[model samples]
Target: MKSLDRKFTLWALAWPIFMELFLQTLLGTVDTLSVSQISDGAVAVVGLSNHLFSAMMTLFMVVASGAGILIAQRIGSQREEDARSLAMLSLKVCGVIGLVLSVFLYTQPGLIAQWLNVPEALIPLAESYIAIAGAGMVFTALSAVLGTALRSTGNTKAPMVVGVVINIVHVALNYAFIFGAFGFPEWGLAGVAVSTLVSKLLGTAILYFIFIEAFHRRIGWKELARYWDRSLLKEVLHIGWPLGINMSAWVLTQLVIYVFLATLGVKELAAKTYMNTLESFCFTLGYAVALALQIQVAHLFGAGRTRDAYKATYKALWIGLAVVTVNALLLFSLGRQLLGIFTDDAQVIAIGISLLGLNLILQPGKMLNMALTNALNAVGDTRYTMVISFVCMWLVATGGSYVLGLHWGWGIVGVYICMIADEYIRGILCLYRWRGQKYLRQAEAEPALGVGLSAREQELVQA
Candidate 1:
């Protein structure tokens, strides 16, 4: 494809996902706002509960993204059967992982909440929310894996549509359940959790039907039982395990930050909660574009078009920077107005606004790190990315947040300053990794093949 054509293709791939993410963000904001009507404590409970959910979702992403890389490469190399088999294996692995996580998280939520130093008053609500949400892990895993499969095959629109519908359902249900509207029993925070679970379950069912009947990509129980390709499984684990660890570390760091914020007292925790919601809105564009580049770059690399992949990455980086810059500026300009939508408390709004100002500097660096890290993973460079992520988040973000924010009495703003420092550090490292062309070597060395393929074909396969 020509440069202009490639840019357009990337945008086409990104925009729908962008809208989907925007809707998802809106859904979150609605959920928070609806719960906020109950009390500030309710919002805090939701935020704390969501930290646990984020960790589980990250684990799911590790497997789904790893499978996506292989699927994209296989499709690029015209290896349809291999791609299908990989998809089946991905489903089975995710299902098993999801089940284990569900049981563990459901049973141990109070321990986890206490570990995070969640407020005593909010702990019960947080625990209840997490336990209910954890029950939907199977649906979450299936939806994520299948969505990634579709994106890998260059069918981004289907996933986007499904995501939109899912969020709509979530928002409607959240409204009904949170307020006892439409004859639904009021469950408050727990109601939000139930709504999310039901939505995900419905989404998984819808996607499964779409994948099997509409797209004709069926993976029966027999295929899942009989297709135990050890080598392929190894390839996925080699790439995915590090990614999982990296994500786990990342989530743990956030939980640690939550612990730190809880010590700062309830107002600070509430401010962080509102800021996180606003930041998600601003960052969605970068996230959407980065996801698009990840799939496109992986496909190009798998097709042996290295130069095209590099060009695509550069294009995506510039686009991500531009998108984030604009959003950051808008958030800064309208900071108070946005916060007002969620809470009437002037103190909370003021604190959230201050957090938004700091986010202006933080968001750009974060966008850089997010784009480069994801693109690198697409080319199977998870090890390096994971190492950098763990070190920066632990040493700079977690450690610095504690020292600057808590130790020195700087409060939540100081914690945010440390977060910005961490983002810049990792962002610079990711840029260097990409510029040094280390990922190119990694991609060339890791050859993917079905155990049944011939040695020569395996070696010569573009992926």
Candidate 2:
């Protein structure tokens, strides 16, 4: 591919993934906004459920990230058949994992809520929301894997279209069920959960039709049962497990931080929830660009163009920083208005607005960390990435938050300060890792010919 041509490829790959993240964030925003109409307790319940959900979703990311790397490499090497097989195997494995997770969470949601130290008044709402969402774990897994597969093949538009459609459906359903509008029941928080599950299941079905049947890339149940490729499965697990564990650990740290904050009381808990909602919108730009970089850099690395990979990484990093900076400014300018959208409570809005200004400090460090980590993982340097993540989240974010925020009685803002410090520390570390020569060495450790693509298939990757 020409140098200029690769730039187009980067945008083509990144934009749809970016839209997907944006839509997902929009869906969350809509969910929170709609639920806030019920009560602040309703918003808090959804917020707590989302924190738990993030940890649960990490399992799917484990598979999706691993499968994406393998698919990108196979496509790069011109191994179409192996790429297809890996995609099929990933669906089966993720399905089983999702089933296990759904069962576990559904059966013991109250127990899970208890562990989170969720407020007694909100525990029932939280448990109800989680149980319903957990039941749809299989659909969530399928949507994530199929979307990643499409992205791996340079077919970003299909996933973006599907995500937008599903998000629209999600928002409409949320409005109807939350308010009993349009002949729907006023199910409140339960309605939100039902809408989420239904939307995800529909998304999975749509993706299956588009990617599998329409594209003639479908891998059926028979294939999954009869053609279990042990070696391919091992390759995916080797690459995917660390990444999954890394994500799971990272989310668990956030949950622990939430738990620490719970010790401060409901007002503090409610403030944290509103701030996170606002932060989600602010961080969407970085998250979207980071995702795009992961796919773009994966293609470059798989094509054995290390120089091009580095260039793409730097370009993406700069772009992410610019995007995040703008978002921070927007938040600073409109912080109170955004907070008011979530709650009419004057005190919650006041605390949330104060927290929003501090987000300007937090967002840039997080943007850098997110972009570099995704870039590194795209090149298969996941083990080191995982180790670094484990250390920072455990030592600085979680441990330090406990000491400074809770132990010192700094309250919600104190916890936010600790979070900012953690992001900067990890951001600098990831930047240093990308700059060093060691990343290439880690990439070299993976097998070059494991997937066995053909020349034309490889050219498709470079193109």
Candidate 3:
């Protein structure tokens, strides 16, 4: 097998991740734009159901994240064969879970939609979208596993290239299907769902082939099934469960708070929807950096470079914070124009303007939290992150939204305030953990994931 051109620099890794995430954000923007053409009600419906579908994706993340972290460690330890086995297990597991979730979402979108307190008029549109887009979860599952595998090995570019293709196909398909151009039937929002399904399937297939070629590995379904290793599964789960639960809690909380905004009325919900789409533009940049930090820190930790790994987290955090601040400001300056691109409602646009200004503070705080959490996750310090996230997401973000936004009559701005507070509080605690060097202690104990170095030796290596 060929050696990977493993340049573990932050920028090298993060740029591709940023481009990939940016393309994904663009796809969401395009989807929202297409749906907006139908009606603001359609936009609200698509946003509501899609958030639910995206929430269910946490299941896929648990397996993929566990395997990806372990794979990075194994690669750092020069155990390629073990990493390959873990990759196969992740693929198999995520595929099975995705199919199960897909069926549930498709079969009972209406039930969940109602439970979410979706407006009665929008319930039918939400059901159609949830059923169609929900079915594509299988493709999304496989792609997550494949993408994580490549990234764990320092090959972020392959997935970014594939994203380019996927987004192009989705945009073209959206035009054809939504407008009945190119001799296709106009199925409105349902057509948008179909386009998403086709694009996801295409991207997943391409990524699978690329993973095989890049890693010089061959896979067969029957062979993978026949050689299922319970022990490997256990190892992955041990490392990943906390991280998964943390993520799941956060997303579910977002869903809950969205319901709070929904109760504020259609205009408030529409503003929230439009604000979310625009916010992703800034969020993706920060998130991409945090993700790259995890990958880099994982390899350093695995290779016994403890001091380097520790420093890498803070270094990436500073850079991420500075870059995201500028990005947030740029987006805020264009907030009204961007809001106008989605709708002509003066009320929704006015509400969105305030939200964008709030996001300037929100994005920086979010970047801080994500960078620290991913750094800890890379070094297997997930339990603390999981605990802090569970507590803060529910109490600070979700619970506070109801109390302040509802009880105190602060409205949507109050929800944003609660969210910002959550981000900063969680981030500060993570920073405190990093300073205490508990992650270092954990690393020294678990030599395989940690850089088997003593405090004294780490200082020398870092020097």
Candidate 4:
């Protein structure tokens, strides 16, 4: 049977993706845990550097996201060759973009440290970490695109396997480098950076081969070298540009919020850092399910099964809500213990527990937003979602965070109120959008997939 003909439940698709994201989240958590052994300054350095690293990743997000959406739809429609071509195009685009941005990070690390308002004592550590870790962006982009390609084709297991390997390598190397174990010299935060970069590069290499062997079978080297489908590339960028912009906008606003948090002092910064690591458990689960929904929805659309697409969206939403709610409750109950895993500081743990209390209310809205936004984007309604995200993220989340947290002296708790507001406000809009079926109408109204498979795709739709 064709891959597309294979039936899938929400869990069948989501669990592997969830495990992959869960391991990915664990990778960051491990980094934080390892770095915490050194000093609060080291933890702060890693945290600040990661903020910049995430923002710089906008380049990969656009291409990977766009390619994933397109490939899913193509594969859903049974245009395997077209899907393969798109997978290659996305890698080619993100590879060059990633390398160029990597160069920027290597050269201008201090600028980012300053931009984040890194405390004076931690500036050197933050700058060095970013420079070293940023070198891995190219590898990271390649691996991410490969993973996205695999997931789009309903091969989520491959990426999950790759993630497991990546995290294992990262953890082992982190232990050796951070503590100078096994005769390795202790390099502190620098060691953490080197371990992370090397592990990511390894993961990228593994995923690259998996992607080619799985998707590029029997295509000659000459054929591969000669094929550069400009139109497909253009279509990918057309779909990806808004997503890239949306991500960049969100990152910039987050950077601004970090600056506001910085004004509150180092302890608050550390508290926020620890809080984020804990919250990742909830958000990442929601994200994993939402991504699965996007793929499933795209497949349904590709098959011209519009009603099933709607059915799948609501089904995925409820699944995500259930998971996020349970996650929130668990985190709330174990807040102190979880926060203590990162630091022994009572004050930081106290701040984090209070913040998790806020997540009780925030997680549900966030889960909804994650599901609906990706559902919208998968159906090619990216522009509307981007616009709404931009407005709500800035006006409500960013601005309100500053006013409530800093000005009101409510600190992290107040900032969280703004965050909950942002999630629900935009989430409601996304739900309404999906319920109204605006994204479906827009996707159907668009021109057909035009990547040389137009005729065949049209036939598939007609049949």
Question: Highest TM-score among the candidates is held by which one?
Answer: 3
- The 0-to-1 C-alpha lDDT of every candidate, in the order given, reads 0.81, 0.80, 0.87, 0.83
* Model 1 regions more than 4 Å off: 1-8, 213-217, 441-463
Rank by lDDT, highest first: 3, 4, 1, 2
Which residue pairs overlap in candidate 3's backbone? 304-451
- Model 4, residue 288: C-alpha shift (Å): 1.3
RMSD of each: 3.1, 3.9, 4.5, 3.1
User: What tens digits encode model 2's per-residue C-alpha lDDT throughout 1-463?
Assistant: 3363343276777777778878888887888778878878877777777778789889878878798887876676565677888888787788788888889878998998898888898888988988998788888888888888888877778888988999989998998988899999999989999999999999998997776652345666576567677777777878888898889988999888888877776666778887877787787867878887887777767666667778888888898899888999998999888777777788777778778777899999999899889888887789888998889888888998888888887777777888888889888888898998475654455335322343344356557
* lDDT of each residue in 85-201, candidate 3, tens digit only: 888889899999999988888898889888889899888888888889999999999999999999998899999999999999999999999999999999999999999999999
Q: Which stretches of candidate 2 lie over 4 Å from their true place?
A: 1-8, 213-221, 441-463
Give the per-residue lDDT of model 4 (tens digit) for 109-183. Answer: 898788788888888898889999988889878888889988988888989999999999999999999888989
What residue runs in model 3 are displaced by over 4 Å at the alpha carbon? 1-5, 445-463
Q: lDDT by residue for model 1 over 200-314, one digit each (tens)?
A: 8988988776665323456676666777777777777777888888889989899889878888888778889889999998899999999888888777776666667777888
Please give the lDDT score at residue 151 for candidate 4. 90
Give the local distance difference test score of model 2.
0.80
Over the full model, what C-alpha lDDT does candidate 3 score relative to the true structure?
0.87
User: Residue 38 lDDT in model 4?
Assistant: 88
